[model samples]
Target: MNTPIDLRSDTVTLPTRAMREAMYHAELGDDVYGEDPTVNALEAQAAAMLGHEAALFVVSGTMGNLVAILTHCGRGDEAIMGDECHTFHYEVGGAAALGGVPIRTVPNGHDGLPALADIEAAIRPDDIHDPPTRLLCLENTHNRCGGTAIGPEPFRAACDLAHRHGVAVHLDGARIFNAAIARGCPVRELVAPADTVMFCLSKGLGAPVGSLLAGPADFITRARKNRKMVGGAMRQVGVLAAAGLVALDQMVDRLAEDHEHAQLLAHGLAAIPGVHIDPSRVHTNIVIFEVTDPLAFLQRLQAEGVLGVYFGGQMVRLVTHYGITRADIEATLVTVRQALRAA
Candidate 1:
């Protein structure tokens, strides 16, 4: 039987051969004691790439975001984010449940950014009644927004708005490398406006596991403690960091291939009957489209060995990743068209 074309997410990607080799031979020490050479190297590389003083290696993107949030906000403080952001819809509300930080939501435009005015209005006043807005969270290549890349200018504007109000900005930049590749800009330029950033190595980068939370050295020092509180501290975890290092070195530039495949997928999906999508809005590897009967459509696609996830309501999401090729994308388009007809 042929291998199924899995488009559910980039998280399903397997590590490269180089990544496996590196993981096997990785130098190890107790990471909790700050003695893991490989883990230390991964963290330092991530910080330098994001233009931050330091970074903390965490098990997943969710944990990285949670650690950053915990470091930035105190109990009863609030965080402002886009209504369509991954942190608002996903991440399981860890910020509120564990850190006592409330999330305030503002409208996200098609371009994947909350309007500056909307963010300004959401800030809590000095009054004792309302929770102070302590953090502004942003997502690049925003998931729900069809992986739209947030460029530097608007990103900087939003960060400046939050900063003027004394609110720290934390970016959920899980697919930031994708955004940078799509916009033809450096990754650091995209994240420079934010106070902290959490990026996933497991997603488009194709590492088996790990995410990094980068920020000021003091913030990372506190985040390391919070990581322990959340059971994210691991001993001798350089094995995982080794894969992340290989991902950083080998997987970043090739994100352009995934972006190209996504554009191809989006345009192909647009041509299909009973499918709704704006190919122009697809900026990275994520492709979101709506069908008349989402359940029936997805079921048919699965039966045909084309896998995609049903996103809320009538929407479905597919992602292009390291292992997916143009041939696979072409086959997926054919399968989707057939599935829609059958549905």
Candidate 2:
């Protein structure tokens, strides 16, 4: 039987051969004691690449974001974020549950940024009754916003406004590499303005698992302790860190291929009757389209050996990753058209 074309998410990507080899030969030591040479190297490389003073390797993007939030905010503090961001919509309220942090939501624009004015307004006043606003969270290549890439200018503007109000900005940059590729800019520039950033190596980068949180050395020092509090401290985890290193070295530039595949899928799907999407709005590897009967469409695609996930209501989300090729995109388009007709 042929392999199914899976477009559910980039997280489903398997590690590369190089990653496997590196993991096998990786130097191992107690990471909790800061003795894992490979983990230390990965952390150092990630910090240097993203232009930060230090970085902490975490188990996943969710944990990375949680640790960052815990480091930046105290009990009863508030964090402002876009309503459509992963931190607000997807994360299981770890900030509130574990850290006693309250979330303040602002509208996310189609371009995947909360308006500067809305963010400014969301900041809590210096009143005894209100929770002090401590952090502003942003998502690049925002998931719910159809993977729109937020460029550096708007990112810088938002960070500046938040900082002026004495609030630190934390970026949920799970797909920061994709955004960098889509914007044709350096990843350092895209991440420069934020006080903290959490990026997933398991996503588009195709590592088996791992995420990194980067920030000032002091912030990371505190985040490391927070990670331990959250039960995220690991031992001899350099095997996974080796894969992340390979991902960083080999997988960053090829994100352009996934972006192009998304364009192809978006344009083709838009041409089908009763399917709605704007190909021009597709900026990265994620493609979202509306169908008249999303359930039936998904069922048909499953039967046809094409896999994707529903994004609530009539929306379906497809993500192209490291192994998805032009052929896969072409086959997926054919399956989508057929499924729509059958539905």
Candidate 3:
């Protein structure tokens, strides 16, 4: 049997040999006591990279977002977010369920930006009947929006609107590095406007686990309490943080390679009959394209040792990552072509 080309997501990426070795020798202590040097280093690095005063390591991206939400908003407060964003659509309503935070949804444009006017209109006035809007959420390299990179200008404008209205902004930047690479800027520039940001080391960075929630030191201090209340405090977490440090040091610059492979895959898929994609819209590693029947198309590809995931409707999502090479993209294209013929 041949190796399967798993294009389901960048989260499928395995830890590198360096990461494994780092984990093996990582100096460990109790993270719950804030004594884990490796975890502390990872948090400090992530905070500085995002231009924040502090950061907290969490179990997953979802947990990071939840902690940010709980820290920023009290019970019965509302959060504004893109309807199609990861927090609203994919986070299982953790904000509402766990934190008693209600969500206000604004339409996300095709480019992954919520219209400034829509965002402004969503903020609740001093009404006795309406829940106060406490937070504004944004996503970069938006998952449902063909991994589009929301540029700095639009991002700043949105955050500015939220800030003026007394609402803090929280960015669900699970793929912020990809957005930074696509826009040819530093990650700090992309994240500077956000009051809080949650980024995943387990995503495109290729770590096995852990995400960071970054903000002001005071905000993170509060979030740390919320994290413990939610049972996210862990001991000896330096083993995972060690890999995260390696990811930050070694994996960021190489994201451009994943972007290149995504473009190659998108262009090839666009040329294949029955595949529907605009290669120009593929800005980063995620390529979302349409097909006649996504499940059947994905099944055929899976049968041929090529794997991708069927998103809702006619959408199929393919993500390029560290382990997937240029050769793998070429092979995947060939396999997809054959699958189309078989259909």
Candidate 4:
């Protein structure tokens, strides 16, 4: 096995033996007919946990988000989301390309929630020229904002603003468990303000595949059809759902440890020369820091078997997941100092 200590993202985590065992024993049926008992159970579990009336299993966070956008907006309708959101920056503009939903971006606050004024101003009136603002999206533990978790004040403000304008709010809660663990709240508390939410089983939860989109039963039915249209309809999906079952049950609480490890890494990095970070804002598994010449920095770190991604310019992100240990993080911290010294 390689000791490279890849911290590029939490998505690299492999399913645990326990999760694989569950997958091996899962009783499967054709999910296209909605008869897969294991998949049904996983959807039900996700719906209950997120305080939603129903849930649908999709192949990835990107798929879940695209389906939600398609279900909420008609052709030429607009989706109001943060400029820093994954849907806008990444995800290949699928909503606009395939669903015909235009993107209207708002700047994100430091905590990763959209500025309420910008969102309110962006809502189109009942005019013929403007694309109707059909939906507002929120990304909890907002990825580009150094994994800043959404708080009640900002989340409530955004949800209330969108709902007051008769627009639905959908949460891109890909790593919501990380946010909930740090805030000492249940996942529902963070996601309840939104009309719909999607969380990943594969990312930090250590499952091989699958994401759950939770919403009202009627909305979920539409999302399921949209999912099928986009090649997300799997027949014997219970194999993946079984691992997600274990992920939901056994992986939710353990996220606190990952957060702890991230905080330690952030603090340790800040102590090193040429590294800049604010450890106070690291409330989850992601620690994004800045160093001079990040491209050169990453290359030097790579020689020592440390791997992470450069987030444009001098910024880089390191994510701690179940696959990384305390010893690994400590070694990573030591390696960072060496990399800086060598720079």
Please provide TM-scores, in order, for all candidate models, with all chains considered together. 0.99, 0.99, 0.99, 0.98
Task: Flag regions of model 2 displaced more than 4 Å.
Answer: none
Comparison by lDDT, 2 against 4, better one? 2
Q: Candidate 2: what lDDT? A: 0.94
What is the TM-score of candidate 1?
A: 0.99
lDDT of each: 0.94, 0.94, 0.95, 0.92
Best by lDDT: 3
RMSD of each: 0.8, 0.7, 0.7, 0.9
The sequence of per-residue lDDT tens digits that candidate 3 reaches over residues 1-343 is 7989999999999999999999999999999999999999999999999999999999999999999999999999999999899999988999999999999999999999999999999999999999999999999989999999989999999999999999999999999999999999899998999999999999989999999999999999999999999999999999999999999999999999999999999999999999989999999999999989789889999988988998999999999999999999999999989888888
Per-residue lDDT tens digits for candidate 4, residues 1-343, read 3669999999999999999899899999999999999999999999999999999999999999999999999999899999999989999999999999999998988889877789999999999888889999999888899988877667888899899999999999999988887777777887888999999999889999989999999999999999999999999899999999999999988888899899889999989989999999887888999998999999988888999999997999999999799999999999899889988
Model 4 residue 90 lDDT? 92
Task: Please provide, for model 2 over 195-217, each residue's C-alpha lDDT reduced to its tens digit, 9 standing for 90 to 100.
Answer: 99999999999999999999999
In angstroms, what RMSD does candidate 4 have relative to the true structure?
0.9
Would you give me the overall lDDT of model 3? 0.95
Candidate 1 structure quality by residue, lDDT tens digits, 310-334: 9998999999998999999999999
Clashing pairs in 2: none
